[model samples]
Target chain A: MSHIHIDIRKKTYPARDGSGEHLAIRDLHFELAAGEFVCLVGPSGCGKTTLLNLIAGLDRHFEGSIRADEGAATLRIAYMFQNPRLLPWRTVRENIQLALPKGEGREWVDHLLEVMGLTASQNQYPQRLSLGMSRRVALVRAFAIRPSLLLMDEPLVSVDAPTARRIRQLLVRVWQERPHSVLFVTHDLREAIALADRLIFLSAPPTALLHEVTVDIPRGEREDETAVEAFRRRLIGEHQQIRDLL
Target chain B: MRSLLYHPISSFLLFLAFWQGLAVILASPALPAPQAVFQVLYQEIRSGNLPFHLGVTLARLAVSFVLAMSLGTAIGIFLGRHEKLDRFFDHWLVIFLNVPALVTVILCYVWFGLGEIAAIAAVVVNKLPNVVVILREGARTLDRDLLEMAEAYRFGRLKTLLHVIWPQLFPFLIGAARTGIALIWKIILLVELLGRSNGMGYQLHLFFQMFDVAGILAYTIAFVAVIQSIEALVLKPLDVRAKRWRR
Candidate 1:
């Protein structure tokens, strides 16, 4: 059965200065098959975040319906914002644990900390962590619930390129253990290519669906230098705008 | 003890020396020497009057402080979260905030007729608006992103409030508490001064009428000492603990 289904007809927000309504996303429709990793790529200010928010049910004012194949009440959704959004007052472990349902044991949490290389920093507060470390913690928290649906909004946008690459690898490793339906939002074409099973492109503000690309390459081969180069060249050959972005 | 006393002792000695010099220069009964004031203080303590009045004043401070803080926080959060409620009562908050504390005390005394309830009610009324104002700002500036995160995760109401909301609002709570305690202490003293049978302010009022300068000085010094200790011991430790997360 399809795990997640989103069929948004229209989503418009009032202008900030009390002007008039601005169309954020309209006629947007998509679905995520179980265990599929779908990336939503678009230009900056393309309302990718808004679209993700609508799917996550964070913004209900928007027109259109988003339904989980499993009823909304039974479906568990985990969201990772562009910002780490850790509770500053809580320790790293506490922040992660807060995401878990009550009375759950420490084994999974300890395992996640070890896997994310966050064991030493578990007792430290969010402010004490570097950007890379904070993002890792946020990822752990998002996955802590072992959620059926995971929503990521450019979760690795800010770090230095090298750190971002490593974190992305760590992300793939974590998700591999339990493949869940993911709808990730990003503007980086390379990242969307590297991680997503399928990519959905949206046009700039007053966003509309533009294109969809599927990566048939096996998961393990995606990390190889040559494979990434081939995918990059193919995307460049096909999508001129995505090439300009890179 | 030695380390703690080193700085405070030097400061206290310097203050005493300055007071002694001023008393000598003025050479009036109104300005007693520190030695004379301490002598009166020692006598009052030995006779047990100082402790009794101080105890009464402290009890009032405790009751009023708790009442104002609890009620203020609830109302502040309610007003801040609900726009219509805020619009309805925001003007009332402004009026209450602007009203002179003395007027509140006088009115409380007149309305309730010089009882414990009146004195405590006056102090609570005086401090409540300020607490509400602070917590209201805290509620207003609440991190919407974090709230969305909590909502997405389906956090229970208790978990959301304790783990997400309270931690974010903690600094504001501390701000309100610190200011509330200081303000309530002063207002409680005034309430006692206007109409009360026993308390530091009542004793001070009696001494003022009789021109017993040393007695007044003794009471003032005792109250100041207690307040200073509370600031140093209670509030300072709390501030440090609450802000351990901050670098």
Candidate 2:
């Protein structure tokens, strides 16, 4: 069954100058299965972040409907942006705590910090942390609230390769421990294949769904670099459209 | 070498030495020696006049500062967020900012009749525009990304304000406060001198008429000392605490 349904009929940006309205997304529709990991893969500037924003309910100007099967009002959603977007003045621990609903305990926060190997730097400000550490804190913040759905927008895009690998591993481990539905947006097809149970590809702006591919490999074998690359090669070789787009 | 020379104590002592030297050269009552001024300052304090007037002036400063800060911050945030309202009142703010403090003081006393309310109102009017401008700039530059983060995380109005909005506005608020305190106190003194019957300014006025330069110097020194202590004991500590998160 679908955990969330997104039917974006149209979304547009009004002209700032005297130009004209620019269509961003049109005739896009998709559903995320319960506890499924879905990666939205697209070319650069394909309104992927805009789509995430629309689903997260940050922008209400679009003509569309995004509903969670659990009931939209009661649904808890956590979003991890492209940047850390942490409150620089707050400590890592406090930044995570800001995500918790009222009267919730700090034990979950402590547990996540320990799991992410950020317990030692919990009290330190974001400025003191490396980019990798800040990303982990952002992840911890997203998970602290234990949202029913998590939306991530290229969260590991700019990190160094080693750090990205570590973060990706930690992310998979955390998601495995507490299986929440996630709609992860990334431009990297290889990264998508490595992490996603299902991959949703998109066309360029006025972006729409181009194709969807289910990763056939089990979660255990998908982590192996050789296996992930081989699967990516096979998938691209078979699909002429995805090969062209990627 | 520069650090030692510019140490606050050493710099202060150098200032005193220069004053003493100038006093000896001029030998005028207007520029009394530091020791002579301190003697007068002691007598004034012992007589209880200095403390009483200082307290009265400080009380006025406190009232006006609080009023201006709260009112200005609210209005600043409002204008900064609403481009239309800001544009409408932009000229008004400029006019108020450019109006002389002396004119405001005279107008308030003439309209409100030489009362405490008039004195404080004058000070508030003189300082309010500055606070509003600083905080408006702060409100304008608020981070849209962080705001979106707050919204996505379900940070309702109050939490968004306390966590996301307030921290971003803090440096601006601090800037407003520091400049506000300095500007308000000076305006308060002018208001007191022009209208009120009691305050450091009134005493200074009396000293001016009698050519009691020593008394003037003494009162000035005592007031300066109090302001310095406040900066050291209150504002500096607050600043340090706020900046603890930064490297």
Predicted candidate 1 versus true structure: per-residue lDDT over B42-89, tens digit per residue: 999999999999999999988999999999999988888888989999
C-alpha DockQ for predicted model 1: 0.79
Per-residue lDDT over A1-246 for candidate 1, one digit per residue giving the tens place of the 0 to 100 score:
247778888888888999999888888888888888999988889898888787777789877788877787767788999999888888999998888887684788888899999999999999989999999999999888888888999999978998998888988988888888888898887788789999888888778877788987788887776887788689879898666644
Off by over 4 Å in 2: A103-105, B1-6
Recovery fraction of native interface contacts for candidate 1: 0.81
What RMSD value applies to candidate 1? 2.6
User: Model 1: which residue pairs collide?
Assistant: none
The number of the candidate with the highest TM-score is 2
For residues A1-246, what per-residue lDDT tens digits would candidate 2 score against the true structure? 238889999999986785999999999999988889999999999999999999999999998899888689877889999999999899988899988877685888889999999999999999999999999999999999987889999999889999998999999999999898999999988889989999999999999999999998888987788999999899889999899998
> How well is each residue in B1-247 modelled by candidate 2, as lDDT tens digits?
8899989899889999999999999999888899999999999999999999999988998899999999999999999999999999999999999999999999999999999989989999999999999999999999999999999998999999998999888888888888888898889889988988999999999999999999999999898888878777977787777778887
TM-score of each: 0.94, 0.97
lDDT of each: 0.88, 0.91
* Consecutive 10-residue window with the lowest summed lDDT within model 1 chain B: B1-10
* TM of chain B vs. native, candidate 2: 0.97
Per-residue lDDT of B64 in model 2: 97
Model 2 residue pairs with clashes = none
